[model samples]
Target: MDTHTAATRYIGPTGMDPIFNRIANWLPKLGIDVAGGRLLAVRGRKSGEWRTTLVNVLTTDDGNRYLVAPRGHTQWVRNLRVAGAGEIRLGRKVEAFTATEVADADKIPVLRAYLDRWGWEVGRFFEGVTQDATDAELADIAPGFPVFRLA
Candidate 1:
């Protein structure tokens, strides 16, 4: 199997850090995801619980907000699928939004932008790995990666 596929297979589905709660609490106060982005708080699909995560606020040329899941098929992605739709808190305002799973073909550029924004860590992670993951490969791993927008 290709490196990207292999990595996804190995990671499988895992739980998130407890600290995510702390980050979620502070994100709104700090006005995260507001001007153009916001924090999405969703319920776990199987676990049926709350999970809040910080994600980049991506605005397409047409004026829609999207949250890209670069980590592939992580817990957040699964939770988003289960929750279907959730809430976004921006500054003092909170709004409900629907989560949609975008296909790889349509999401590659956005994924590339996300990796670029997180270059330092992403670069370091792939530093020693012989099988460097291409943007397309990364997208393929979790094809159903979630993208959230205002509902």
Candidate 2:
């Protein structure tokens, strides 16, 4: 499937994924950004229940806010696609907004910035691409990482 199209893909996590994700989910609840994380909540496409997980929110210099899925088309990513909207929450702060996925061709800047600001935490997920990678390199991996602009 062309992830650049509507069919996004996923990169499975290692065994430690659940452990780290669980710990990450706690930091923001305690008002800590141990991973530059926030709680992302979206309605379940099947159950209509709100589902949440820890995610990284990237804000560029120009004031655009985004959510990048290093783990690729995760459950939240699929739900967000179906829901078309979601919430970003810190301890007590919740910002609900609509989201639009960025096309692979246009994800260079967003991907670079996301890696630039957070590679230390998520670099392994990118198959060795880094913040300093060329645009072509980032574009090659763009389709695999779902990015959303928060409005």
Candidate 3:
């Protein structure tokens, strides 16, 4: 996650990515759980229609749950800000909840935990930070990663 890599790696999903997400969204609907992945259905800010995407759920050590957007300023993030609440669906099971945006200063531990769990998938976005990274190091890159405290 060098500066150059971090600077360039987070281009957001493009090209075939949406197609892949559409397919991934199906597995959860089909009753197949993929690494705690779920279909996150949130109301679109402008369209007022449900926008669905695949997201991996993170359960912290304190029994709290979270959703981290490694890609900064993404559509889902923007929609969540307006909608305030959303649903996470896994097959027939769905959990409806509210989301609180975690402040950048408070995201170090959450970001660290996220990297520990899914860094292999999202590490590129962190600018080279890792789970073993120092608190100062993680804090330096925290703002780029948006975290939601779910309840």
Summarize candidate 2's per-residue lDDT along 1-151 as a digit string, tens digits: 3545424666666798879878878888778766568888899999999998988899999999999998888899989999999888888888889999998798899999999999988888887889999988787778788889989
Model 1, runs deviating above 4 Å: 1-25, 29-37, 116-150
Model 3 agreement with the true structure over 107-145: per-residue lDDT tens digits: 999988888999997777676779999999987776667
Best by TM-score: 2
lDDT of 3: 0.84
lDDT of each: 0.58, 0.86, 0.84
Model 1 TM-score (2 dp): 0.62
Displacement of residue 81 (Cα, Å) in model 1 is 0.7
Better of 2 and 3 by TM-score: 2
Of models 1 and 3, which has the larger TM-score?
Answer: 3
